[model samples]
Target chain A: MELIKVTIDNKVVEVEKGTTILGAAKKVNVDIPTLCHFKLHDMNIENKPGGCRICVVEVDGRKNLAPACATDCTEGMVIKSHSVRVINARKTVMELILSDHPFECLVCAKSGTCDLQSLAQQLGIRKIHFEGKKSSYRLDTSPSIIREMNKCIMCRRCEMMCNKVQTVGALSAINRGFDSVVSTAFEMNLKNSTCTYCGQCVSVCPTGALTEVDDTARIIRALADPSKTVIVQTAPAVRVALGEEFGMEPGTIVTGKMVAALRRIGFDQVFDTDFAADLTIMEEGSELLNRLGKHLAGDKTVKLPMLTSCCPAWVNFFEKQFPDMLDIPSTAKSPQQMFGAIAKTYLADKMGIKREDLVVVSVMPCLAKKYEAQRDEFKTNGNPDVDFSISTRELAHLIKQTIRDFDSLPDEDFDRPMGESTGAGVIFGTTGGVIEAAVRSAYELHTHKKLPRLNFEELRGLEGIREATIDFDGLPIKIGIAHGLGNARKLLEDIRAGRSHFHAIEIMSCPGGCIGGGGQPLHHGHSSIIKARQAAIYKEDAGKAIRKSHENPDIIKLYDEFLGTPLGEKSHHLLHTEYFNRKK
Target chain B: MATTEIVLKEKQVQQIKDICKQFNNESGELINVLHKTQSLFGYLPSEVQVVIAQELNMSLAKVFGVVTFYSYFTMTPRGEHPIDVCMGTACYVRGAEKVLEEFKRQLKIEVGETTLDGKFSINSLRCVGACGLAPVVIVGDKTYGAVTSADVKNILKEYENK
Candidate 1:
């Protein structure tokens, strides 16, 4: 390690290779307030990376204070993390930043949770300074996220996380210098990006600049409607995240408490999204085989690397960036969309409920899902199938406001048939989940043999890129899996260049998949986000007895009664869909 | 994809006109019209994008974000000079970043900003399908793999003269 000698407040500190002055200050407990610098990938408390001038420090003999987060510590470098001069510079910078920002944090949705507010309080910034040009961004209500560009600090943590950690590049600095806004390439809404509804961006945001569109008020109205019957479905990721709002561990499985909480919040039925997740595997697996067979027979030229469509963000990404690959997207709609379609169609028929009368509310772990609810694809019989979608964070708040003593609530189970989920369904909360779940069903259906190993260890990891080869029946199927947008680019490029020999690939927009979704409860750019979410997914998966989607008895009955079997003609039309080759 | 002639068709122009009717200020909605036109036609031809300015009462430069900021909306007729530089994390760290900065210095334009000539509209892309070849730059139809700061002036000159 290259040793760098640094002096802070006249105290000498030695730090190692490639370490920044701010990083070195952190070592000596020299607390430097930073507004722009943050570490999006680091899940630890002290690991957040640097960005703004708030963390500026005096470097011995340097002309101006370099941003501590970006400036590297050097040998024989004299640094002052804090001083009267440093404090004034930082305070002035804070005042200047606050000048351009909206002051409605108290009345804003992010009041208690805002990083800017917390930092302002820490710095004791009381006086209003220079008033600059206030941004006027139309509050985009296009399904997934509510982006108030006026509230944006341009710390670039969201863009960095979305572009770097996730590899989605759904967000970026869209303009030059001061006029820049972190936006998708056409100032399009988040739902327009191949944003997987994994609400990871919302989780990392310091302000309400990026937030899951709050549909709690809408859901409440739906539940209170005297003529309407409201049905709720909770994604597996929700169970893992709900506990975070209540001061519980990130990975705590609040499945029973979650069910009880939703019921207490006034839902007529509490169905599990895991049930639909199982159904997705059965349908997607069959769809994959049919496409593969078609490709092998020269019957289809477009049916290769059938990208998983369940990830709304990834779906949006493909449609926007690589529209020609639409033919490659699985015919299967996302589990959320599939659930909404089936809840209105199959479940509505069995319950003798009118499709118009049933208000299907989904408790999701993603914000992009809220956008997916309104996409043109989700509609079959018109009237948006999923009436409202609230994130796990919003659901937790609604539950807290409605259900007092939620922790003391009795363990409850999701209603049967539509509520019953397999181990494969539970795994859907994590990355490599759909691929793993599909493998279990496909291997059995094609080879007439069990998957043998419970852990598909090859496909499970935190890397941006992962590749695995499996021997199923008589074929050696190569598989690739990627979590986060960055990884997706690498994996997709391989396929585009014809260097990728993999038959299938799984891509999620978040780092740790759905458990680390964009709309989950956020961390302060500390490093614990992914680790906490991953622990939650694994815990949920371990707790399940029957893990494979095909093993779910309800799923068996689903095929036995309505769909016939996996890959059947009916499954393709009702459950699956396609994509378009977007223009450059 | 809709051609320039098709975009100018009564139905398409009428649709853009209809969209302008919804917004309170038609000038504010010019970019949206440009976006619609780009959606209709794959790229934003100067003539068509100018139609947006004429219809919405905004300047041609005012629709820059709608024309260039979005990956979906293209300007300068696309195929003429598809100069793209990789700006992804790995590429940025590997120094395609410096090359991109130098492109602005050399070509007198920024990432999304096109040249005055319009024959060489430079764009910095997010990892232009070439990561293994670190610090990658693509000009027109050719990939000028593994570029550096020193390569920027030569690269621009190569495109300019060509």
Candidate 2:
């Protein structure tokens, strides 16, 4: 690699030829504050619009301060990051931004974690020098995400993620100059637009401009009602990442602590969404095998590559973009919905409680799960299967609001039946987990032989798209795994063109599956946090005695006592759903 | 601005499709296609922008973003007699703000707005290259030099019958 020497803060540092001054400053530990610069190191996703102008630094020969994020280092370059002139300009630009911004940080949802708030504190800004008419916009609340354009810093991070990374094309920087703001087409509500409610936009927004809808209030109300028996199901991804809120490391596994905290927070029964993940695998695996069998038996009518429907964002994506191939994805509902279905039916029936008296709440690593549970098909007579779905971040807030010491909480086990899960279920938090879980069961059922080894190393990785061929005795099952909606789009287009060769495909909307979900603890463009969470998920999976979904005792009992078989009529009614053609 | 549902002619729709095809329907050439479409349709309403987006294989929001970014583009149709008041340094020093305010009063419309009768629309421009004619106001292509608050009503009366 071509090397260049640059003097940053009077310290000479050698970096690659194309390295930005911001990247080179880390060598000598000189900090240059930035606002609109976001980079996911390993994922090759960077959003540096150079619009904020907060990272302006003085160059010796330049006419004006250059943006450190967009400026590349050249040989023998002299850069001063914190001269009085540069500092004054940076502060002035920040003041201008603040002038147009709303001064309601105390009540803002993203106040504590907001990048702009911290930057103002870092700059020691006491009072605004300039004042103007702050931009006001109509508050837009969708099923999963909320848009408050007044708090927008014009970072364009959400715009980049929506159009470039996720390929959702739902948001863009509209209008110009003082009126310029990121909005949907014609400033229509998100529900009317083609937004998939993936929450990638919410994940990247630096301010309170975009956030997941606050459903914790509704959950709290349900828990306090005397007539209600509120049960909460925490997704597998939440366990690995929820501890980050309490100043713990990114990969800290606090599953038992999370369950204990939930119990103390007034949840009548604290269960695990992992159990439902295993249920999903049972139904999805059986559906995959049935499709593969028919395809093998010369049934051209059946769709070949059966896609996983655990990701609600991926479901919404194919529904809007690939309406013609809607039948390809498996009809199995997501883990959140599956848990709600079982909790409201089989569990409520056993407890002799009315469905109306039982409230089902899910803590997920996804914003789309909120929309998924509220899906019309997942309800009966206007009652949703899952009454409410809160994000991992919101659960942390709720835990803090409960007068309970989250860090000092004692470890506790989940409730019986619904809490029991295998390593296959726990692994569902990561990108390759769902497909690996499905393969474990599909292989044994197809070959009528036990898996020699449980781990399919070929299917496990952080790559955007992966394909592996596992030999099922004499038959080879070609499997495809894709995380991130953009990567999913590639596989989808391949299938649309009859180019895909896989029999089963798993697609998750987030980058690293649920571990990198939009509702997880803010990584702030750090891919390492996501990798650490992925590692913790695998660790949880490896420590379990029962590794496969089919081997779980509770699942077997569930089949025997309640739901008959995997693809039985009862299971189909509770666990399966169909897609809509939202082509407009 | 209200997005009135205007029924575009078959020829107009075919003409937009031909303009998009002229640029090979590349999404990167969105600005150029939008310029052509706007020139043909007088303004880029939602219906016209929707056609461009579908033809270019882009989101309507992206197309709208590009169209709204540059001041040269407009989403609303311009009135029969469009007015432009110079707000450059020279014009401002010569009391252009007073002239603009007078026009808003007489025409009953703010800057970047149209009168109820659709006969006049007012907007502000940086410079008309007529620095000597400071405080200039242009009605369509005709330029009025050294315009004052007193002349605003007379300018409106000139375009009243036309």
Candidate 3:
């Protein structure tokens, strides 16, 4: 690789050729403020439209200021990052942006965390020299995301995420000039569009323009209801990311503290979604083994490479984009929905409470879980299995609202039965975890052998897509795992083209499974945070006594007492769901 | 306004597919394909863009973005007799804004909108290379020079009920 020397802010630095001015500046520790330029290093994801001129730096002898984010440095390039001209131009650009933006930072949902607001404060912008009519649009509230396009600064990060990253096709830059804003087709409601409620757009948005629909208040209201039995289930990914909201280090595991917080927040029960993750493995594993058996017997009709339907966004993606191959995915409901189903059915029955009176709330690291809870199929009659689903960020807010010192709280165990989970179930938080959990169970069930080692480290990584062939007593059962929906699209295309040889595939919509999910604490364009969270998940997994989902005592009891057996009639009705063709 | 359904003919659909194929079905050629499709069909509707997106293997939102980004492309159908009211700097200084408003009032439609009867559609153009004829209003192929607010009513009368 070629290297180029550049002088930024009188500091000489040598960087690889094709490195952006922003990259070269970082080598010498010159921090340049930027917006509309986001890159998750090692994930092959970047959104640099060069639309925001806030990161402009003066190039020596150049007539125009170059956007540091998109401008590549050449040999002997002289860049003045904090020159008088550069500062004035940057502040002027910010003022122009603020001129059209609403001054509602005091009450905005993205008040402190907003990238644009921080940039304004970093640049010491106190007054707006340019005031103009701010463009406003109708507020769109979907099941998972809220689209407040009026707050949009035209960064196009969400547009890049929705189109290039996730391939959801739910948002794009529409109109032109001063009236330009990102929107769906005809500015239609996102629920009406092909949006999977993935929330990757919300995750990448720099302003309050895109956000998860705040369901904290609804959860609070449920907690306040004296007649309602509010039980909260926290997803595995939530534990690692929830601590970030409380100013804790990234990847700090706060599972016990989160449980204690939920209890103090007035929940009747605090359970782990990992338990339902175990239940999912039980059902999905059985289904996979049954299919593998049929395929091994030369059953040509059986769909090879059964896709994991544990991700609601992934399910919605295939339903809309690859409707013809809907039958290929395992029908097992997601951990969130399965928890809801079992909570409202078996747990409700055991507690002797009416299903209508039981308010089952889920704290997930995903925004799609909110949509999944509200899915019509997950509801019985008019009552949804899960009454409300809140994000990890919301749980942090709830912890704050409860006025308890999260730092000083005693580590408490989750309530009995539903709280019990194995290391296999807890790994569901990261990419390749769900499939790894399945393989742990499927390997033993198919080959009828207790393997030498439990941990399948070969299946684990932060890669977008991975394929591994595990020997089920020399049967060579191939498994494929894709984290982001874009990667899933590639694997799906290969499957459609008859080039795929995998027996089963695990697909998660977010980049790094639920840990890097949209509803998790914002990663702030840092890939290391996601990597740290993944490491925490593995650490939590290694500390557990039972490492396989099938070995969980609670899950075994549930199957023996309530579910009867994996893929049995009762489990099928409650834990399985069918897909629809949403191609329009 | 609600988009009315237009059942495209087989030949027109084939032409759109062929246009996309001409660009080798690459998503990067979205602008060119949209331009050709818009010129061929007079407008780029959602259904038409959906076809182009499928052919190009791109998302519909992206296709919609390219279609809406350029002012040259539109989703609404153009009328048989399209009216262009120049809103260039010279035209605006020459009271083109008032003339444009008068046309809106007379036609009972906003700029870039067509009449209910599908006879006349109004548009605010930048310039027709006719700054000499400042505040110009072009109806079909004929240009009315130095048009005023009062001239808007007569311009509509020429294309009315024809």
Query: How large is the interface RMSD of each prediction?
Result: 10.3, 1.1, 1.6
* Winning candidate number (DockQ): 2
lDDT of 3 by residue, B1-162 (tens): 246678778888899999999999998898999989988988888779878988998777778877777666778998889888888888989999999888888889998898988898888888778899998888888889999998777777877678
Least well predicted 10-residue stretch by lDDT in candidate 1 chain A: A42-51
Docking class of 2: medium
Question: In model 3, where do residues sit more than 4 Å from their true spots?
Answer: B7-24, B87-102, B105-108, B127-137, B143-162
Per-residue alpha-carbon lDDT of candidate 1 for residues A1-584, written as tens digits (9 for 90 to 100): 67878887777888997988777887888887776666645432132345457888888788988788888887888877777788888888888888878889777888888888998898889896778877767786556667888889888776666655654555666655567777764555554444555566677677878776788988888888998989999998888778878888766778999998888888999998999999998888877787777777788564577777788878777776566556766778888888888888788998898899999999887877887888776776678778888888899779867978878999999997789987789888888878988888888877887778766878776766678987886788888888777678787777778787878888887767887777777756654655677776766777788888888998889888887866667776677776765532
Highest-scoring model, lDDT: 2
lDDT of each: 0.75, 0.91, 0.90
> Candidate 2 on B60-115: residue-level lDDT in tens?
88988888787667788878888989999999999999999998888778887878
Per-residue CA lDDT of candidate 3, range A63-96, in tens?
A: 9999999999999999999989989999999999
Task: Give DockQ: model 3.
Answer: 0.61
Top-TM-score candidate index: 2
Q: What order do you get sorting by TM-score, best first?
A: 2, 3, 1
Clashing residue pairs in candidate 3 are none
Candidate 1: Cα lDDT at A551: 88
Interface RMSD computed for candidate 1 is what? Answer: 10.3
| Candidate scoring better on DockQ of 2 and 3 | 2
